[model samples]
Target: MNTETGVTAQTRPSATSSEGPDAHSAPPTRGQMWRHLGPGIVVAATGVGAGDLVATLIAGSRFGYALLWAAVVGCIVKIALSEGSARYHLATGSTILAGWRSLGKWTSWYFGVYVIIWGFIYGATAMSATALPLTALFPELPLRAWAIIAGIFGFVFVWFNRYETFEIVMKILVGLMFIIMVGLAFLVAPSLPDMARGMTFELPEGSLFYTLGLIGGVGGTITTAAYGYWTQAKGWRGMPWFPMMRVDNALAYIVTGIFVIAMLIVGAELLYSAGIALEDSDKGLLGLSGVLEERFGATIATLFLVGFAATSLSSLLGVWQGMSLFFSDWWYQLRGASEGGHEGSGAYKFYLAWLTFPPMILLFADRPFLLVIIYGAFGALFMPFLAVTLLMLNNSERVPAHARNGVVANLTLAGSAILFVVLAVQQVARLLS
Candidate 1:
């Protein structure tokens, strides 16, 4: 992995060298799998936060497997969008923030405003989501207490560890959640015919909103923009690393797509089959855990809850780390200090603090509605911001000819932009209403 320029360096053999022993060496082994699996894990873990789970469960409960296809499509959209961002970083040797900054100062201003508003709102949401399971398991503690603990824990982890340690921890959490959640899906034995029909992509009656949400919700967020930073941390840069980066990204989302679909299967088979409807909150997950306990016994249910907790915790940590990095860069650029001694400065810690602490005010506020609304509005717009920008940046002359956006890439990104705009409109309407 080359870290100098953001582009991945190519490793393809020349046509004449294809027949050599080096070229014919045995294929990469299982042990080598770990090397290529890093970025995917981070992307998936970041994308599959608590909000995604709630959306999937709600869709399953309302329409069974009808929306599974949308979930898969969402994963494809994410791969295209995230890959585009990563490719830009790998090809340009610059951060996404730098790319956006190059476009114009307005790009920087929009991101700055969005991140501050988004982080404060998201901090409370992530803490509350993590607190739900903890409060359920230990009813003696207040939810506020649990939320504070979760927030502080996330803050400590991101503050203490550097990128490498953070990646390893998140990978473990992702593995645990993937195994338990997917394992539970198999145990419930989903209906193949129903799943196949879902693959056909027809929207069921009264499910237009659900379908849109599923398409917009699958493993996506502001964290998608963080792909380049993570790639830099992995020492991956230049076009030589492009093949491996693509493979890493594709495999990551493949796992994420499977994980989300498996959850939908669980919802369809376990909850929907039993006529269970989950609420639009993390508490809904606790209710589902109760159903799991009743059907599969206490042990399986406990495992599922643990996985749920890990997912929420990992997300908390990820947002704290990734968003802080984004905010710090934007802040420095805002001060017109694009170069000099301020590059890669220590300002990220301040943003991390902002994410962890200020939101606690909402945890105890008399009314939390305004905070939630502001958060949702900004959060809704971020995907479109990323998609539209990537389309513009990757196709611009700033990128080298070899790495410029081709027709297929442009089409995919355009579709993503359209889809995200629709979702963002719906989200705003919901907030205003």
Candidate 2:
């Protein structure tokens, strides 16, 4: 029978059948389909935040399909990492923060400090990204005004909806984003030779930044840790749910991987061929849209902008909700508060406000140089944090031996950790210089 996690259901035989209880049965109902398809969508929606889209588009424009290999590598890393997080929850029935607490106080403190700073900086970034498309669509409204509106709208969406409703909305937005953006990829014919070469596993000259960026952007983010929370939200608890969770995480990142590859194709075929350079900011997307209009038509350009808006705004909503959950859970643990009753408590609303309002200040003034440095530096550190943590946590005694990392997983995690440390060192050195 189909389960709540939206994985492909395997059949189990009825009691009367000689084939055994885990054999064939009738197919699952449509209702079961909706129930099972949740955590993947939540994780996917969170992973594709605006910064990721910008990074992917830029990588495509610069290196064409040469960096598509990085995107594929990124997807594999995220799946490995996310599966580790979800598996921890299903195996131990504890939140990742709680699991970290089990390890030591230092773990808790590290996460606390990281989350607060990350949320503050990310709030401003997400708001600004969301506002860019709105400003372009209706130039009558200033960018700052649109940013406030987007923030408030995100706040309200998270403030009222339960987890299920939130997932539904996110899935719809993700659907629209996939159709419009990925559709453009097919319309622009790609070079089979170049795409094949990209898959050959060789890095091109002076392409380190682009390669590292694709690796970093492939659905890696702070919200990744929040996968445990989404797992809980979907009522996926205990080892019995582990298979479904694996399927959910895999399918989500696979979709993300395909979406990213499509964007790279668009970059290879359209921007790189035309000698167009994408701007460094969200406005760069607008410039790209204009290019699409010139090459295609206004209809295609407007659709691309709409897809951009959906991607950015959906990410804002997800970060606001997911991080808020992460923060509130951390606060409750620190205060020795009771569990299972904090869902929509004051702590949750407090973080929701934290993500929505204060950062708006940056929209008016120049995003302070020091703040940018701190954000970029710490942001660069998070993927490694996730990679290393998954290695430690999943391989620990707490995890069942059966569920622990194999040699393949260990090597992949180690590679990802090393890659991020290199990127972080480079980012920090750049900032200091």
Candidate 3:
């Protein structure tokens, strides 16, 4: 029960309240589980922003189907991380922040510093990303103006609404983006034999970085850690919800895999075959739109732009709502508050505003050099931190024996840690250079 709102499951509590139905009843059957898949949809749509699509698309253009296996591998790795976090939540009945607190103060220091710096940098990043397609589609407004509008709209939307409304809107955006992207893929008519060959793991020369990137970049972000919070907001609690949670996660990533493969197909068939090299940024999608217009006429190109906007806005909304939950939980837990911060809480709104307004400055001016370095340094280490901590938390007595990591889970988590560590090193090296 939420003490502030006096909300109970019987009262149909708003998502802003954070308390879900207690796990006193039996779990839903498989037949009934489909409808309970909101959290996964939220995570999937949130994770695959424009940057992720760009990375996969670049890989497809460079290597054709050779690195297709990397995209599939990326989905599997994220499943391990997300499942571990969600399992800790269900098994121990604690937020991930609580789990981190148990490990040591180091976790707190790392996360506290990380989230602040991350939110500031990411706010501008998300806004600019969402604005790119919009600016392309509507040339009357400048990019900076569209960026501010996107940020404000995201802030207002998440601020006023509850998680249920948020989830419904995300579902619609996901369906819109997914259908258009996949439709473009089939319209290009990808070669089955080449894609099949790409399924076998082979890294081409000079492609090591791209291969690692494709493996690491697909739908992996801070939002991945927010999965448990989404599940909690969805009213799932305890071990009884495990089967439903697993289905929710697996299906979501499976869709992510398909969505990624579609982008790769577009890259291979549309860009690579035409010998076109796109600028390597969010604007790359805009460049792709020009190519689309030339070949498939203005209607298809306009549809792609709409899909691009949907993709970017979905990510902005997810981060605004989801990451704020993370910040809220972190803040309250730091104060040793018994009741966790939920959607409508002061801490939640603070982070939401922090993500929305402050970043708008970057849209008008250049990013500060020191801030970029700091952001990169902190951001690079987060995945490794998540992977390593999940290993320690879930394998320890914090989780019940049955919920502990098995051999496969252990291997996958360990591999993820190593992969992230290597990526972190590469990022730091690039920043320093």
Candidate 4:
């Protein structure tokens, strides 16, 4: 029997197709498939924040179509990681943190410290990043003032709403961003032959970190660990939902793949073609805006900025809500409180405050140097942390035998873990250097 959804092995649907045994219902139709696309969209939007765009833009600016293949590989890695995570949720019906607790108590403390530090720093970064396009578009308010306003807006939205409302807002933001990015991509009109050559897997010298960064960082992060919560929030049940999970994940990441590919096209066609170098920060996007103005005029630049705002704000809101759920669950587990109903819990509120208010200090005053160091230290290791943990949980005897990790899943997870480890070490080396 499947432990999470209480369905027997005989009734479990194949992950590839919605089709399953006669005892279970037939696969969901295309309409139903469209409906199941919730949590996946949420995860995708949350993971591909401003920083991810920066990395991809830099990669494209430096190498043009040379590293485009790495972006595709990065999406595949994300699919495998997200599939592993969603599988755990479907097989166990528990949050990832709970699964971690089963692994050992040390995981609890590790995640706690990591989030405590990372959330504080990320909150500041995300808000400021969100404020960038707004400041560019509307210079009426100072950047710091706009950032504080953005932070408060996310805080109020996440604090008062439930997951359903949160998902709706996220979908809207994802839609806006998607339209803008894809539109921008088409405007660039990259060469098809160059893109094909990029697919041939030639990693140029000196672009190894850039390549690895694309593979390791493209649409993958701590937000993935929160994916299970999204699954639960979406109210999917039964072993039969596996195919829907599969479809949902595949389609969502395809959208993410498109978004990344679009940004890369922009990087290659616009900045690279024009020989304009962007600052290796979120401000790089603003620099790109000036390019758009020079080429496509102010209207296109304005549209791009709107899209950028949608993308950054979606990340801020998703992290605000999802990680609050993470801390809330952790608090429940730590305090030995009642199993569920932590939405209004103190820990949830505390983490929300952590994500929202404390970082406002960084908008004005200096960030604590030690806190920044610790954040990068732990943050650097998060992808590998999730990959390794998923490998442990999904391969354990807890999941139904038929539902356990298959060969492809195993290899993918292992590769992701190893790649993330290399990336993490590289990040640490860079930090120390």
Candidate 5:
């Protein structure tokens, strides 16, 4: 039951037989497994958008190194959830939506409403986020103009490209983002002793919300749920693919952990010691750019802005692609299509258009109050919903006995569910009030 890899009835060949590596004949070597690391990179790039960076920056500005431990713990918690998602897919050779469907019609109802509404709201949000640094860098255009251009760019790119092209572009963007963020952290030269002290568990005064936000916000989003679909897109399909999938998931989040910790270091060394405060929004990253210009110079500030654009655009591209894949699968499954929807399908294009067009209206004017309320309520519950559903699906008989959740996996996922539930309650309360 505890073995790392084995095949079962649920395991099947990839849909496009040429996509995945040949893992069935013999166990893949470390080098071979590393070559197959695409989906995890996609997930990581998609998950860490501009908003996540701002949240971490704010946490570091407010609490210094005090909540560093929470950020690391957040990564671990997400690792558990994402691993469970990929594990179910590999062990059962089914999509997560299919797993949700097996649970009951209630799952479909929740997802159908959630994905559509989430797409509409998040489209505007993602476009605005991607546009910020661009507007900051090139001020001739208004923020709204840059946002629309960004949305169109993402829509065109995803609409025309396949998964292979998408993955390659994502890797390039992720690499650029990694270099810029980690480079800035090094430029600041953080104190080693203070960082070490931050590793010990201690929350400063008035730090509870910031601490929770850090733990909950680091490199996680609905993108975590899209991970299994990504694995399938990469053509990994069974128990034989399990070991490689685990490695990919862990490494991606490890990169995410480093990326987030770098931002925290920037906040701690550059802002906290000086008592600088950043606005608690995506625009706050632009505030950091100003700080960078003052201290480092125009060149470094421009570099930071470019990195910011990379971060934001990568997220926009990822959601446009990954969520569209998810929406297509869910719709086709609901209609009982034997051969499920794929890229370039009608449902897929509809979602891509849906994500790109309808939300553009919100950019021109304020988001409607009622729609905002509904989006917040549903969005807040999504993480908890994912955590809970994974618990039910993975522990039940749908998965093979050998690939079921171990004790550590169970505890970590259970903890994630509780954490997200708390966050959801707070978010809903804040939104309604």
Candidate 6:
């Protein structure tokens, strides 16, 4: 039915594109479950970059699991957001952009400005983050050189590979990263009883912002809205794939929570126990690396850096591909074109190019404070924006009655919006001060 590339359920070229013989053909087998889980995994891996890990580590270092429940809550919020997005796409065959446009022209303009400003700033940030561990791993290369190389590597990889191949590569990267995280957690030997204590619904003194960050910042971003495009790209369309999509989404976030939980334990046992403060940034991860080397050996430090690279590069690839999906679909819809033209289309490549190259100029210059504030405020507010809009869309008559937001979905979305607003307000206050 689409007019752009004229692609349909039957016409998708990827080997894994078919949802199944039919949507409701049968329950997914083990192999089928594995196949359909790509989109959520991409979102989780994308969102949990170095900054997220550092935030969790800082929280654990300072509060010692007093905010542990917040991390679990963060995963739950993301699951709700991911499910709502997937449901909208399958129910309406619509993109999130289209859903926003349904709300009002104001929503459209807001997203346009947000995406332009957010992507320009985030691109440079993502590259610098990726460069950090690589420079640590190979001390000879300056961070700037490593950053540009990281950006180029992400660009070339995503530019050539479609969703299926990209998904496969990311799966491998996350798997390797997972092993490293788990191994580090083991080395730290955190007490399970203390972790249990931390899980209680209690907040530490003066840790309000840290708690809110953990709640609002786990496993989500503007990229979370890209879930639908990934579902479509994965060849799962219509109501039949709905159940499988939910399963896929839930499983992905569960893995995200586990990875993050391991990180918290590392912070608790290593940094908290030792009275170490990482000063709250990606540099904290580097400081953790030095501690790991001091305690375990150089080999341990080297492995962690490798895992860090995997985490960083995985995010870079996801954003490069995920944002391209969003921009391409937006351009297609705005021009009265079909959604089918979106995969690696002109706009797709343009955004991909934007994410990779233009940001490199900022890598060479000093980062501006005003640009950081604008980026920070929007970045902080995005999840709240997403939660609020999803509440409107999924609850509206636009989605199928059966698939619309139920009580649990509504509760989670509402809670996510509130939590994000708290974090957003706090970020604005800090920036202004």
Estimate every model's Cα lDDT from 0 to 1: 0.78, 0.77, 0.86, 0.82, 0.85, 0.81
The whole-model C-alpha lDDT of candidate 6 against the native structure comes to 0.81
Q: Which candidate model has the greater TM-score, 2 or 5?
A: 5
**Per-residue alpha-carbon lDDT of model 3 for 122-223, expressed as tens digits?**
898889889999999899999999999999999999999888899999999999999999999999999999999998899899888888787777786678
Q: Quote the RMSD, in angstroms, for model 1.
A: 6.5
lDDT for model 1 comes to 0.78
User: lDDT, candidate 5, residue 255?
Assistant: 94
Cα lDDT of model 1 by residue, 106-207, tens digit: 888899878888888899989998998788778899999999999999888888876767788999999999998899899999888889998888788999
Instruction: Tell me the TM-score of each prediction against the true structure.
Output: 0.90, 0.90, 0.94, 0.91, 0.93, 0.92
Cα deviation of 256, candidate 5, in Å: 0.3
lDDT of 5 by residue, 321-426 (tens): 9899889877776776544457777788999999999999998776455554565566768999999999999999888899999999989989989988998898
N/CA/C clash count, model 4: 0
Best by lDDT: 3
* Model 4 stretches with alpha carbons more than 4 Å out: 1-31, 339-341, 366-377
Worst 10 residues of 3 by lDDT: 1-10
Q: How many clashes in candidate 6?
A: 0
Tens-digit lDDT string for candidate 2 (1-433): 2222121112321101122111232323444544477778878877886677778888878878888889999889888778878887767655676667766777778888888878888888888888888888889998889889999999998888767788889999999999987898889987888888988777888889878878876685677778877777766656776667777788899889988888889888888887889886667888888999998999998898888899898788888887887887777666664432144768788889988888888777764556666777888877787888888888987778988888998999899899889889988987888
Which of candidates 2 and 5 reaches a greater lDDT?
5
Ten contiguous residues with the weakest lDDT in model 6 = 9-18
Model 4 residue 152 CA deviation (Å) reads 0.5
Cα lDDT of model 6 by residue, 1-433, tens digit: 4423334323333212234323334446667776556777888788789888988999889888778898998898889988898898888776677777777767767887788778889898889999999999888999999999999998898888888788888889889889999889998998989989977889878888878878777786888888887877777777878878888899888989999998999988899989999866677789999999999999999999999999988899999988887877666555554433465677788889988888888888875456556666779877888999999999888777988999989998998898888888988887787
Query: In model 4, which residue pairs have backbone atoms overlapping below 3 Å?
Result: none
